[model samples]
Target chain A: MTTPTSRTRLSPQARRAQLLELGARLFATRSVEEISIDVLAEEAGVSRGLLYHYFGSKQDFRLAVIRHAVEHLVEQTAPPAEGEPLERLLTSLGVYVDYVLDNLTLYRSLVRAAAGGTDELRALHDEGRFALTDRIFREDAQGEILTDTPQARLVVRGWSAMAEEMVLTWADDPSVMTRDELLSVLALSLPALVDLT
Target chain B: MTTPTSRTRLSPQARRAQLLELGARLFATRSVEEISIDVLAEEAGVSRGLLYHYFGSKQDFRLAVIRHAVEHLVEQTAPPAEGEPLERLLTSLGVYVDYVLDNLTLYRSLVRAAAGGTDELRALHDEGRFALTDRIFREDAQGEILTDTPQARLVVRGWSAMAEEMVLTWADDPSVMTRDELLSVLALSLPALVDLT
Candidate 1:
């Protein structure tokens, strides 16, 4: 009989990605504290020892999951290359709406982790948000859409916070408003927000 | 010793409020699924039989907790009687900020429940939001701030959603922004949002 190949044959990146995806699904359905390493290992078809071997501990596993979610959000909402700053911002908002609708479970998991009082988890959550805010600030400054200053930083942060809250509400009720309708509202409000006038 | 007063002597409203307050505290720290009638009774320092006698069932108890949180939010954010519509709206936002900050644990619990897929819970969540949105919409309409139609409703929903998300972010990091800062941002943006001209 041919010798069976080892599970380690899979690359580290692929394994990490798989673990994150599984963790998101589980965390979305139940509280983080309620989930156990044994359940995760069983679900993943890996031994409990192997699961711990990869993630080190349950908390580390959660952190990895949060990082994955953040990375996915950043990739989805990256600003477009060629458009008016306003148009680019609207496009980004549209992307966010689509992401939230498609991944409500994962998005809620991310929001829960961020909102809960875990410093490391909170830092991971802010990483993606700050990145998106920085890009918006850069584009607005380049196009003279906003005055460059420390105060402008607050505008970006405020806008980001508003957009996040809007998405959460939308996720709660898709029938309440279409994604484009929501984005249009933001687009109309953004010029005033950035003080384009 | 004198016999304890019968259940008839206790006001139902007061008893219901007591159960809700206890439920909120337990749910905030633990999963809803993890919380049993027995545990809630024990935590409240009441007998399990009395707990059931008050709430009727676990589901009813959960609903009561959600309703209590919603009512508390409404009470805090009631519009100011004598002010410019804009001022009233901003004042309302400030009140909301204060409520969330003061009741951080309970607010977080309500948010988590709303995000979870529970229809009754979500309706309770939206009722509070709609109450705030309706006030803003009426102000906008009376001031000729926004076109009166479904489109405007979408804008109101978006703005309300953004406000909710901002509160969650603020709760996570109180030092990052102040209530005044948030109100100022909204005050500037609302006109652009509500005023079609």
Candidate 2:
């Protein structure tokens, strides 16, 4: 029933990756609710059946793309294993800001998905935040494994939200200050905010 | 031509306010996109024609509800006319927190509408944010009007977003801390974060 001209020449893994990349690109600027599987398949030059064959459903595909983006972020912003605490923190912050600046679409897409009011998206976002906060706390504590108390959890969660908003605001309008100035402000603010609780 | 049983027996202004109140209650938990005009009208026990007659359209009614909510917030949290700068700021923060706690539904509705991604909603949200930030800045300045630089605007906006997220998180799970503890953390954090820039 299928014409040879319409067939994708890539292998299954390559084709799946291709579709996911296309999904990330489109979802970077558009909401998941707005994009349909048919249109996504059409845009990717694949059949809807093929798209479904790789990912069981649209929700499954969205979750896959989210995981892909989160892994990319964690890899890109991974902190140094050994450095001065403050220096390591600053470097990590710089890496974060740089990544956002370099990949505005991907960063925005990730943030929007995190805040898009779904259990899966929210859980994925929290997973990323917990990893980042744990790193920061460990770095600040000089490798001591601190107790993850409710109070500590609350402080880190609050700090994470603040950091996210700061980055989002700076990304939306870098005219407020140079990237360094924005980074410095965030670095100064986070420790003080986290220490309050 | 009209059935007496289906008519609302209130003055036009009263009927309009009734419909708007209904809208606020519904929209607090539901997005405008999810709620239909006919559904809203039916919920208010009025004809769709009467609902349209008062507000012209669904979007118009939504805007009106947003304005009403913003005005209510402004009125509720309007800082005391006389107090020390920090004192006044804390008082305003307390009032704001109390209002949000007292009227979670209305607060959620306003925040959702502001973040609902339409141009109109974004603009309305900006309007409310500017008003709140301006008040905060003026109060912190202690009766002196400071220059509203882009950096200042960015900081206040970032702080506002942080406050919103913290309150939302706390509201969703008060087991983390008491309302007073959460408020104290926010009150302590905002100044430090805003002072960074």
Candidate 3:
């Protein structure tokens, strides 16, 4: 019998949040398919019954954990509202690149999970992508660099896909380029695709 | 009840190829999961047993049809090895964009199937993507425009994703840009990201 030192008493909501964070962190190292309710419960020092009570099923638990991570990621990459549009865009891209690189394992696992194409998981991934795209349109509209038209949105969205590919490839093996080179290429890529001169 | 005019007097290999072409065409309008062997046989003026004999199973049939389409796509978009690199890239991109636009229904279905991420299907998609990217490096290296570095390959691959996104979105609704405009934007985008200036 040992004390639940890490998971010491918390309200149910707090405990659930803590468990999701733990799951997200663990998912970085362990695949979602590999980490079942038993593993999660054991890792969090909770009973399997309590986890089922919180999430209802393994599928539900996986979705919730990914949802939590996506929300945190979206929140983390929000553009600062007070800077010049270009500067703000660069700042956000810098953070986005660094976040993905820093947690490359989690990011790669997340893509593999989404690529596995579980319907709810894929939907969650698309929703997160759209949310970040929306944020770019809304937050980075302070200058002429970004416009609010559907065409502009399409260009930016396409650039998002490009940057994602570059960052993911670079993060997979950083020796392909230096971090600063990768960041500069990404920063230049959007305006270039949009042909903003 | 009808005469098997199209199915008459063919070798077994030819019949299988015909059915695969039929499957690929139908997949343009129907999801891979939705079409059944009975329907294929009915449409092909053959028996379900023959279709099964040729394909072994529905999964095998799906992979073959997708593999056929992807191979055709890679071939259709190949750059000319005899032209100026810039002209060659633009011409290949024009063909590439036109191919996607003309085959919008098939292209969308193909992506959805790939996104569904069946193991062989996803691997086939990646193989096709890498094939196209490699073709660009080999065919476009005649001039000083494209260097054959890992970093350069990374840039072109990222541009491939960018162009794919842009073309798919625009093809979904071409009102986004004129074909010439989309072609120009895509052509300019690669050099821009590669920092050719």
Order the candidates by lDDT, highest first.
3, 2, 1
Task: Give the per-residue Cα lDDT of candidate 1 at A105.
Answer: 69
lDDT of 2 by residue, A88-193 (tens): 7778889988887877877766776566446687788878888887877766664332345576667667667767767877887778799888877777776676
* Tens digit per residue, CA lDDT, model 3, A1-197: 22373558888898889889888888898866787788887777778899999999998998899899999888898888786776777788888998998888898778767745477887887788889878766766554566677667778878877888788887878898887788778776766666632
Model 1 lDDT tens row, A21-94: 77777777776565677767767777778778888987888787778778878898887988888788888888
Question: In candidate 3, which residue pairs get closer than 3 Å at backbone N, Cα or C atoms, i.e. clash?
Answer: none
Q: Model 1 interface RMSD, in angstroms?
A: 4.9
TM-score of chain B of each: 0.86, 0.82, 0.90
Q: How well does candidate 2 reproduce the true complex, by DockQ?
A: 0.46
Give the Cα RMSD of candidate 3: 3.7
Give the Å shift of residue B168 in candidate 1: 5.9
lDDT of 1 by residue, B98-174 (tens): 88887776787677576543668767877888887777767665754455566566556656665676666667765
User: Residues B23-110, candidate 3, lDDT per residue (tens digit)?
Assistant: 8878888766676777677777777888889999988888888898999998998887676877887788888888987888898778
TM-score of each: 0.72, 0.85, 0.83
**Best model number under DockQ:** 2
